[model samples]
Target: MTQSMNHEETFENPIIPGFYPDPSICRVGEDYYLVTSTFHYFPGVPIFHSKDLVNWRQIGHVLDRPSQLNLDGTPSSRGIYAPTIRYHQGVFYMITTFVESKKGARRNFYVTAENPAGPWSDPNWLEDAPGIDPSLFFDDDGRVYMTANRVPPSGREYPKHMEIWLQELDIEKKQLIGPKYSLWDGALKQIHAQEAPHLYKIEGQYYLMIAEGGTGFTHSVTIARSESITGPYENCKMNPILTHRHLGRDYPITSVGHADIVQTQNGEWWIVCLATRPYGGEYRNLGRESFLVPFRWENGWPVVNPGKGIVEMTTKRPHLKSFPWPTRPACDHFDTPQLDMAWNFIRTPRDHFWSLTERPGHLRLRLKPERMTEICNPSFVGRRQQHMTFAARTMMVFDPQNEWETAGLVLLQDHDFQYRMESALHESKNIIRLIKREHGEEEVIATQEIAGQRLYLKVEAAGQDYHFYYARHAEEWQVLAEYMDGRLLSTDVAGGFVGAYIGLFASSQGHDSLNVADFDWFEYIGVPQQ
Candidate 1:
């Protein structure tokens, strides 16, 4: 439940890895709190805690209640966007946009809490707030300001001609009360998708930091400054203080943008940003992850990574003491009263389709009518595929009473793209089948009759190749599918804002069934490729 301090002088680049992206950082006294966007996933916006700014541990989620967020049929990459976390006067506030699928409308809202560990308050929705990636700034003059991306009143003059806007927020009423002003768009007038703005008043001047050029290969971080909160802001000579676009297509880390800067208690400055690790060519199965880079203000402008100017895989640690978390368990035995923080559901569950007390020491999942192929919540539970070289396995006792019911494991990219291995009865015989769904089309890869009453399912990944295995007896494994293409699970091909996941699933496929999949245990582990 806690992390021990490490005395190491160096730490890795991605302080936090996997699918977590769009990192926003804030420091309270000596303790640092960070949050990241979780699109199309339940319990949106995970909050992390760190002491040294290098090591971190997930404390909880910012939106944990169903009443706070509703993503019943949200498509992949279309739910929660970027979030900015700010602390003020004994109160913690988190502001972000909920990107709705209905005509692509976005609603900006914020939630507050006294403790970041959180029994957070309901969202205080902001009216007249358009666009996404909303941020909050608490100025020292007893005034609060909200900044976000929006189009000009006259509309855009060119493609991706977005603008950053500023408005005064009433701290007491939680609403915008002053005239809105359009801040600087970007140093490059034609920069595409200019967004993710964070305001800071430093050294008698107000500074505006933002992400520009979209969230792809051309993604970048830019800065501007002004003497007043809402006025003519001057662009930094080195506008893009951080980016990986010019490094070419084969860089280890690409799409490096959406950064938030924080100054440590020791007075050292750092930037936390989201970037993708593309392996086996340009396929990023790990999705956009959070990375930390050294930052400082030089000549009244921000300088990222200084001499290097690029995000590194390993770098010097912060001046503060290390706060390394104890190694997390690679396996969950389903003995706990609740699911671990590592698990997340796709969209929000409208009803109880899963339980822990039903089968004592086992996670029981009911065979629901909903399927993963659609946007609606299905009978599934999953965790991120953290390592490029990893293995995920689960021991389950499931027997398909009919051909309409299937329950087992899945290697999922999104609702339309995935590789599902499930248990069923073929010709009245127990069987396990491997099926793939790409772009709403599904094809069965392999099928085999399973032995014994219980089934063991597993999938292993070595870089980009995924191998599926199964066992009917303890320690006796058989290859159901080998060297299956994993690139189909990448955002490059699947086109989403999420990474791949290994999860437990049970579906009736539009049929009514009184069946359940009892998972005795689930294990996921990462290893260095041999």
Candidate 2:
């Protein structure tokens, strides 16, 4: 076993930081693959690959095609839930549930691909599979089982009452067969919302691990084991193998659960899960991020973080050799043929609405009739605000002939809660405006008229407070809005399962327009925390 390393060599927690939640990982040989939930964002389920478990790079997304993912009219935080990725017989199977479709329908589906990256098959809808967080387990005898959380057939005694269910799966036929059986309710009695179940067979025992106590401050990971795959599983005496809930709200890391484990080629065990790094008193603008923790077997159960028993902000590196991956570019010049993996749209993007090749070295966004606040797809593309203190700047040249057309930078959380700073023609004058929307009410906090066509817009965040600035020249920046409360863009205030996104947006306000906005470049710089 590898001993703890010096501080200089230690890897940081939240190995894959920023809005990457509900992490599910699978190891094949020396390679480790991971997947995270992307609610309502098209090209969903970002897949990442790592060699040493500490350094990871996003290889691709599972649902890259519009046909594979349909999020039209789906609410901001209501489309795709937790997704579980598993490798079986040279094929990668990703199972997930789509809740609140355009027509308000919920469904479960799975997709398969020979490789972890690219060209994944279209959704094989599991018409009979009920519930979210579906996981596929291939037994030693080549039998496949699907495990997920669903309402008990006997009816719920209380709200959010759920149990783990297992059913036989036919891989070739792409369907679930045989009788469904309840494996374990949960580790705690009367605990609602027991979900994100993953089954493993180790040393002749079938172990079932699950996330309980919801996904909030009380989130936890509990384990149960049984003699048979389908049997009366018994809860572990040292239940809740990992959690940060009991550490109090003052803890740096909160909401730690929904973990997936993998044993390395050198026989080292590690767990990757979702946890939040809150700033300025229990408010997390970065949302739940992927965190890593080392664990060891005690008697038979895994002891997470060993003597610590709680997730730490920094931990010793995995025993395997370090394989450092290149970091994403700090600025995007729109020179690439396609948007980087870091960029995502609100929903399914209209093919002709945006492009990078239309004008060399620029991202052109055509004016769309739908407003940014609408449920439909808007001409918007953004990256997650991954840091508590950062500055996001974009240079745009928009010549709006009418008041209906607007384009600029936005710090968006959802429809009702967002901050938009844009340049538009108001009263036949080219004016820059700063608007804030809270719970469906809109307010124009700042506005300025300028003569230049090229404008530089920036939003600087410092500990839950954001400052909006614009410049006619590249170096001259004037504050347009100051000390704007960023908490309004948080999940706690916005009431969603997503984090803040900073991106370029264009809207026509229900009027057809041929006008387009050209973004010369976009840059994001993380400010060091004090």
Segments in model 2 whose C-alpha atoms lie over 4 Å from true places:
1-8, 101-104, 528-530
Looking at model 2, the pairs that clash are: none
Off by over 4 Å in 1: 1-8, 528-530
Q: How far is candidate 1 from the true structure (C-alpha RMSD, Å)?
A: 2.5
**Candidate 2 to native Cα RMSD, angstroms:** 1.7
Alpha-carbon TM-score of each model against the true structure = 0.97, 0.97
Q: How big is the positional error of residue 201 in model 1, measured in Å on the Cα after superposition?
A: 1.0
